[model samples]
Target: MSNLHARDYQPDRQGTLDGIRVLDLSRLFAGNVLTQLLGDFGAEVIKIEPPEGDTLRGWKTEGIETHWKIYARNKKSLCLSLRDPRAIEIIRKLVPSAQILVESFRPGVLEKMGLSPDALLALNPSLVVVRISGWGQDGPYAQRPGFGTVIEGVSGFAAINGFADREPVLPPMYLADGVAGLYGASAAMIALREAEMKGRGQVIDLSLLDPLFAILGPQAANYRLTGKVKPRTGSRSTNSAPRNVYRCSDGHYVSLSGSIQKMTERLFRAIGRAELIDDPRFRTNSDRLRHAEELDAIIGAFIGERTQQENVAFFEEAEVTIGPIYDTPQIMADPHVIAREVIADYPDPEMGHIPMHHVVPRFAQTPGSIRTPAPALGQHNRELLAEIGISPAAYDELKLAGVICGG
Candidate 1:
């Protein structure tokens, strides 16, 4: 059992990003996820929001916007008006010490606010700036408003994700934004290192339109070479056979992927169909794909005759690849998730005893932790301003002037 003390961890272990600082001027999932990645690895992130607050603050379920809480953890929230000159001056003051600055304003929004990359980099020569956008910082479509759903459709992602006959489905989650955030986090670190080596700052122009399209793996190459678009084969792998979800006797779904020859042979033998292995129509992968529907029907019949647990037992004993489809409840109750501590207790003052997935890509020597809960709006404003030499009297005056607002 892990305890909440430094002594509990190995003596040599330390947070890898302990000394780095980030100023987040971004909104929504893409920018939030990117900064959260850095925060999870021990960067001190100060999230600067407008006086009104982030738009996601109102995205609620039963009157709670858990999205804000989940993505804003391990960071400080500072509320200030960008339109105010005093607030702009305060941001300028904070820039010199920040190692990273991330923003997701549209192409020209930052420039209009007088906080462009060129100006920010000039203020702190060693800083790394990550500018997240929809179509990107420049290009014909740069200024067009784009959401994750819209981008998924426009990026050629949603078009090929469903059954060929069905209306295409957007991903269940914010897939494009999340993928872009992951890429942005990776790019930020790389740019930071490059800046250190070159003794200057660098700007990362990240677009949500790019990463998801880049990760559609091999489809682009296949199309370029063959001039053929891949048809959607619902719940089946386009490149392999016997890789689809099957309904068991109890009505629970079990997905199987007996794609490789070894697993295919094992599956056939386990199902008492050893004779079919030598049959010309089912002898090779290419041949099986040619008759995938027929093969899938046979496998489905076998699976349908057995309960999910029984099928699981048989697949485990036979070394055939399979897994029961799980909803959120099963995932929370799963043995493996518990054993690995994948979900951790995220203690919050307002929303107590919340469960959140813990930090990932854990390191042996420098693993990170969720040191703080998500901050209340402008929770760190007083402390942050005080650190920058603002006296209490001056702070109260600024708050009264509508230049800064924080509780």
Candidate 2:
């Protein structure tokens, strides 16, 4: 049976976030990723797109690479041309009924559109507004046009991610955008909850820089306490020894971490070289780190006898921390991934059972759900307008004026 039909994998009839309504005014990856996440958690997200539609609509493959199809799952699209006063009026009407609003335009763009947080809050005192941007809304670079790669470079992540001998490598994925979206979503959720508690609303100014800054891990701490800045060390960490990726007999790679003494000793024992535990050159983490090349060579020689899978199982059995550097197919085929239902088969309106990477942070009673597929442009325009108290005559007038479009 398909995993979607597995008895235990059923979605909540009453999803934890079932009653919340989110108005998504964001575009591109960062904002869309956030709204998609909220929708997966059962928020009724109404995506308000401009008449030109999301630019990502053109982000396609000749065959089936629909970036919009995946990233925009579980939201209804409502098209409005904000240049028309009617379109602005319609969004103003919708704001009172929405619990949250998310936008990712440059600073001042939404205000120019007449959908500013202060304006919306006047209409709905409890509305949680989340504004996402590459830089913050108030920073010196607030007006600058930026994207994932640019911000990743500016945030110092790209600088410290590549091999020491080569130019700094850009991350394979849109790490900045995606992580910023997560931070925005989390901030929106918290702000919404706080607003509900206080009976007042606030705007969440979530910058892409926040996640880049937060994701620095130890780099920020090291920089804060000392005068030194971090450089690219490839797979090695700043705080530990024997914590780099290694090659196995099958020409596959794996990572092993052993910063603590007991774990390092265990790793030595697992390789049948317990004498290394007492060796002066590798007794402490500091010593092992100083002689990392020698220690890594010794470990690599032992790993040369085993396939990645064999090594993974052997180290796991021996209570050593290790992971096979899995490819996408390998990850999809992993037993633990299957057991966790990390991949979901969502029924798309345009296509059959489209697969999606499932939601995270599971709940026993009211977990998130993938309720609906992404809509075609302006798919829910009329319906959303009707829900927001627009009369048929007014809707027709707006459509005639090129202010509202969907039909």
Score every model by TM-score: 0.95, 0.93
lDDT of 2 by residue, 245-326 (tens): 9999999999999978899999999888999888999999888878887988998888888999899999999999999999
- lDDT of the candidates, in the order given: 0.86, 0.84
Residue-level lDDT of model 1, residues 5-93, one tens digit each, is 12111223237887799999998889999998898888889999988787767777777768887788778999998999889999999
- Which predicted model would earn the best lDDT? 1
Q: Report the lDDT of model 1 for residue 402.
A: 82
Worst 10 residues of 1 by lDDT: 1-10
Candidate 1 residue pairs in clash (backbone atoms < 3 Å): none
Regions of model 2 farther than 4 Å from truth: 1-12, 63-65, 218-221, 349-351
